[model samples]
Target chain A: MVVRVSTAPFDPGAETNAFLAAGRGAGAAVTFTGVVRSSPDDPIIALTLECYPELAINQLASSIDQATSRFGLLAATVIHRYGRLTPGEPIVHVMTLAPHREAAFKGAEFLMDYLKTDAPFWKQETGPDGTHWVEAKAEDDAAKARWE
Target chain B: MKILYFAWLRERLNRGEEEVSPPSDVATVADLIDWLASRDEAFALATQKRSLIKAAVDEKLVAHTAPVAGARVVALFPPMTGG
Candidate 1:
């Protein structure tokens, strides 16, 4: 398992390929990439992700452990980027490898669900109107509750 | 103990972190919030939104009622919005 909290942009394709290669025996591999979204009503020029780096890494490591044991995953990786990011830039990437497609898919979803609410990162969107902190959605909490 | 703030809390508090030594009566996270709220207007305002605030002790999320007696680090922030 690999968990990285970085401020630098990364190549998702390269990371995916490396994970797939490392889990050569795994028959299924699933990857999820989240990108910054521009607001339709108001034009968001950039997004700033603020986080306590040490705490963020620790939380993500625990998440990987939970996903691995619960889903019986062969391998997993999570890369989350903090700092300013323009719209359309990659914000986070998750990849899961398992012997079966079902496990791989479910594991990826589990990681993403946990990361959405459990991670230490907070997002602020900056646009023409000015900057505003993004509020946590109740839907995200509900989505995570399904796994409990 | 080290007190850390994040997101808008950090911005509103006008600082990110500080070392604090609360009185012995400050035993729980809630108690710490109450004590902190008395420090200044910014803290009072921030703690006023208690329902919207989330906290972590030593990097682990916990309830406001959780014990803070032996905690080395405490973090306060809004709900997470990451993926």
Candidate 2:
């Protein structure tokens, strides 16, 4: 397992290739990437992500560990970015490998669900009007709850 | 103990982290929050919306009623929104 929280933008293609290369024996691999999307009503110019780096990493690692055990994953990777980013930029990437496709898919989904609510990252959107912190959605909490 | 704030709480409080030595009466996360809310207008205003607040004691998520007798760090923030 590999987990990274970085401020620098990453190449998703490169990251995917690296994860796939490392999982030499795994028969199935699943990847998910989250990108910043502009709101139609209130167009956002950029999004700022703030986090306690050590805490975020630790939480993500533990979540990954749970996913590995529950889904029987052979390998997993999560890369999340912090700091300011413009719309359309990638925010996170998750990849999972398992002997079969079901485990790989479920593992990737599980990691994402946990990361959405459990990670200690906060997002603020800067738009035409001004900067405002993004409110947490009830839907997100519900999404994470299903895995429990 | 070190007290950390994130997201709107940090912005509203106008700072991120601080070392606080709460009175002995502040024995739980709820108590600490009440004490903090009494410290400054910023804290008072920021903590007014209790439903939005979430906390971690010593880097582990805990309930507001959780004890904080020996905790070295406490973090307060809004619900997470990451993926």
Candidate 3:
């Protein structure tokens, strides 16, 4: 099932449980929660997420579809938050369930990795001194490349 | 012509979306970029790293040589840092 990518915070455990329950044949389930870091080298006081609403949702759904088709995931869900967010707040969450532990683990990682590098979202970080827009990290591209 | 900018490109351009009418000879994205740069100094600097900056005709990423004369929307962004 797909979760609405919204600014509202959600209970991670409940979300995880639901994903696991959906996968009746799956023996392993893994989840990842991406939170706002308290300190970043760029001096982020806060982060504001911007996206093309319809386009963002469609792209995310398409990514999930690709993962499911390629990996045979029993179930998965992705929740991403947008707009102004404070440090330590949840930015994104993903859960993957599969029959094997490896697929479960790998699938979760893949989802997050693609979401980082390919997803259509714009992030602007505001700091104590000034506000600077975020850029796609070389590290993120490298991370995504490993799975490809 | 709908032009969109993302990431640092947006910041440097100091604008997000704009409607533009390029010269009749602007047949490709490369030509359009040259025209845009000629309009302002910032465009020249920001577009200097043409290899690093990516372009998408409509929603699909395309190469610098891609035709843009008929494109309805054009997007420019730096290599993504979205994680």
Per residue, candidate 1 scores C-alpha lDDT tens digits across A1-148 of: 8999999999999999899889898799999999988867868899999988888888899999999999999999999999999989999999999999999999999999999999999999999989999999999999899999
Number of the predicted model whose lDDT against the real structure is largest:
1
Put down candidate 3 lDDT per residue, B1-83, tens digits, no spaces.
99998767788889998999998999988899999999989989998978767777877767789999878998887765443
The iRMS of the candidates, in order, is 0.8, 0.9, 2.5
State candidate 1's TM-score: 0.96
Q: Evaluate model 1 with DockQ and give the value.
A: 0.84
Where is model 1 chain B poorest over a 10-residue stretch in terms of lDDT? B40-49
Q: Sort every candidate by lDDT, greatest first.
A: 1, 2, 3
Q: What's the DockQ for every one of the candidates?
A: 0.84, 0.79, 0.42
Best by DockQ: 1
Model 2 interface RMSD over true interface Cα atoms: 0.9
Q: How does residue B8 of candidate 2 score in lDDT?
A: 82
Instruction: Please give, for residues A23-100, the per-residue lDDT of candidate 2 as tens digits.
Output: 898899999999999978868899999987878888999999999999999999999999999988999999999999
Q: By TM-score, who's the top model here?
A: 1
| Ranking of candidates on TM-score, top first | 1, 2, 3
Instruction: Candidate 3: list runs displaced more than 4 Å.
Output: A1-3, A39-44, B23-27
Q: Which runs in model 2 stand beyond 4 Å of their true positions?
A: A39-42
Better of 2 and 3 by lDDT: 2
* Pairs that clash in candidate 2: none
Candidate 3 lDDT by residue in tens digits, A1-148 = 4846776877787887777667767688889998877655645678888754444566678778878887888888888888888788888888888788888888888888888867667788888888877766878888889877
